[model samples]
Target: MGDDHSAARPLRADARRNRERVLQIAQEALASDGLTISFDEIARRAGFGVGTVYRHFPTKEALFEAVLLGRIERFVADARALATAEDAGRAFFGWFARVVEQAAANQALCDMLDGGSQAGPQVGLRPGSTLADDFGAALGRLLARAQRAGAVRADLTGRDVHDLLRGCLTAERRSLARGGAVRMAEVFCDGMRARTY
Candidate 1:
């Protein structure tokens, strides 16, 4: 079998630019349309040809994965930055509120948490995966710090915080009322607070 030299070569400058453009378009589409947005639409929005989009991201799942990874990285960075704040509890809850609001607005995140994307059942973020682990670890550090500061309940673990956030996101998706996500997060955070007898 002949070796594939193309895989070893870096993308041309134009191709790199095209790939970034496609990713940006795809991210916006995914935020608004979830995974239902088609590659044709993405290409049109990016001012590029369908072939260029396909050449860069071969499949819809591949494109979504790239977009999702970038989003996760952003969230992780935000969490890390907030972890250094003076008020541990406030920092944790603030990050939580921010994430919930963003997630509620982002259809792709809501869809992924609900299960898989519209593309396929297997496109969802699974537990123990690298992306999931990274996100969880960052959130866990905040939770632990808050607990140590007597902000959050001592009984709660990182998994519990994760579940609570997921519930808030799901509720926000189903609720008919506006600002439902903010309300849910507020209530959840209040309930998670440490109790003094």
Candidate 2:
């Protein structure tokens, strides 16, 4: 999903195909192995040479950043779409749960959200960047809509919700039993729900 938007000439057809293949392979590896997997392993899995992998992404950090940005873009798109739902509370909570579940299963996402990776500080997403801002803005819109509908607690801010999400991810990541993450997410949703007198 990463593209070259620089002033450089466009890639040849074969080169473009190879780049896409490497990105796809790296995406899968990040999901399963986080940043622990090497470019050599990616090259081997991609059925290409290491030089091919380096041609597109000279460093492991570059490839990881590209993959992470792509994933975040997709998530932001989903949040934007969900913001239009008739049931604002369900839309917000449902999307939240799905994100937690998916991230719990994804090593790269978990590590990124945790604020660092085993590979080093340069490999993870930084706060206040365009990618984070886009996601936050989309989520903030959903939160505001839910609050206006009286489906969510009025006292909660977007940052509060994000903190809660991080907590849910942490709980899920640390839970020893299966379905712990799902259960914890449900608890969070319940806590976020508005109370009726």
Candidates in order, TM-scores: namely: 0.85, 0.87
**Best-matching candidate per lDDT:** 2
Clashes (N, CA, C under 3 Å) per candidate: 0, 0
> Model 1, residue 70: displacement in angstroms?
1.5
Off by over 4 Å in 1: 1-11, 114-119, 176-182
Per-residue lDDT tens digits of candidate 2, residues 72-137? 778789999998999999999998888888877676776676555444687555688787888889
Clashes of 1: 0
- Give the per-residue lDDT digits (tens) of candidate 1, residues 42-109: 99999998999999888898999788778767888999898878999999999988888788777677
User: Candidate 1: what lDDT?
Assistant: 0.81
> Where does candidate 1 clash, by residue pair?
none
Q: Report the alpha-carbon TM-score of model 1 versus the true structure.
A: 0.85
Cα-lDDT of candidate 2: 0.84
lDDT of 2 at 29: 96
Q: Distance (Å) between predicted and true CA of 129, model 1?
A: 1.6
